[model samples]
Target: MAEPVADQNSALPDSPPDGQGEATEPTNANREAAKYRTKLREAEAKLEATEKRVNALLRAQVESLAAKELSVASDIFDIGGASIDDLTDPEGNVMSDAVDAAVKALLAKRPGLRNGSAPWGDVGGGRRGSIPDAPPTMLEALKFTRR
Candidate 1:
């Protein structure tokens, strides 16, 4: 069959020549909404992080209380296995290292309670000699004044 000739009589719609359609510029309202959405996302992320930190702190507190109760009930505290100082939050507050606290408690009732010196075996050589229970730090030594 012979192909029919196409119709050229109808006019095309009076619109912009479609290359790519016109890029719509964002309105001020659209820009403001986008800004608010970004801010909301940031706020959500910040809230999530804060919640995690708060949960950690609460868990630590619960653990601390449990440890104190266990120590006291087991006579560890009474027998100087853990001191009141150990049960408390230490200065500068490393959040409750239970093992460290317990060890401090155990060592609390030492020669310092009496007028006795520490066992020489605490230092090297295990020989019978008295040493200061706590040696001075480097900072303390540096402060020495010898005229």
Candidate 2:
């Protein structure tokens, strides 16, 4: 028996219908939306980096201002729980008046934070005695005896 011939006018199983094939091509709206999404992501990342830099600068300014009046600025940052925003204005500029007020308030509350105030006694060798005029011999050194 002979095999039957396939018809040329019939649609193939692997190919989509003629009118529906246009859907496979991307539309201008889709391309524009993708472009905007990429731009948005880049903008968000840049904003985050800028915020980190601004916060670091503000923190340094706060510490420098505090250091001028106090021996330990970390004590104020740690104990007072102060934020960088507290020392800076809405425009991200350091507010010297606010910083001065904060330092004064902290010093009033913690008198010890003031500069030139020693927390402990002077650190030195405890009552060191004068050494002998002559150097000891190796044998005397090995003896471990004190003058």
Candidate 3:
């Protein structure tokens, strides 16, 4: 009532039995092909995941490092609100001596900036000379007169 399957080894090409057209044994090459395909898929998936992890880590590290560097720079250069208030006091009665000292210190640190006169030279120091009488234009007011 049932048909018997031929043994894999006994199914030779030259001696195929009746009802069997040809020997069709599963070969090592087919099995190896399937195994390699599975391995390739697994490797591609792992590579994608590793790339995602590395990108995320690098992004986080860059942001954290930038924030840290900004914090350090702020600590180093932040002059604070009080210093600005002191510098902006309008009256000539303000503490100009301290401001002058700070400017001199900065000029000393950066010697290249000392080529010109101080910004407050005209305010505190007496006028260098008298303006010429009957100054014709605004440009004439800026000219230095010999004492």
Candidate 4:
């Protein structure tokens, strides 16, 4: 009968280097992992808070631009179901061209939101009738006295 040979695959597991035991190695590794996980969580939380602030600032900028250029209320954007992303580029910067396009689209969809100013020059309260060529009353005669 042939003698059985020890295979490399069946050999004993290697021991930790430098006389360190396996138990202490795992504990140290776990502690480092836990520390890293805690730091990651904190960083993620700060990132989330920063993103919220950025979105708020971007929204404010959109509203202010809409009010100034479109002469419309901030609600106009909401009415169109448009979000901040629609008004911004990939870099999160507001694009004036995009804003104009969005406003145009909204105006087209809702004509009532047109930037019609207050009844400016003359709505009605001005002169009523045409001036009489022949000076009907004495008040008209005062014009000749001043000349």
Candidates ranked by lDDT: 2, 4, 1, 3
lDDT of 1 by residue, 104-147 (tens): 55546442332133244544555576687999998778789542
TM-score of each: 0.32, 0.57, 0.31, 0.63
lDDT of 4 by residue, 12-64 (tens): 67766676887588889999999999999999999999999999899888877
Q: Tell me the lDDT of model 4 at 47.
A: 100
| Model 2 ranges with Cα > 4 A deviation | 1-22, 25-28, 117-147
Clashes of each: 4, 0, 0, 0
TM-score of 2: 0.57
* Residue lDDT tens for model 3, 1-147: 778988986775565555344333455557888999999999999999997886555434433332332332121113221242343345422344544554455445544444333355446566677776874776655564532
Candidate 2 lDDT tens digits, 4-63: 877875654555766355465566569988999999999999999999997887888788
The residue pairs that clash in candidate 4, if any, are: none
Model 2's C-alpha root-mean-square deviation from the true structure amounts to: 13.3
**Evaluation by TM-score, superior candidate among 2 and 4:** 4
Candidate 4 has a TM-score of: 0.63
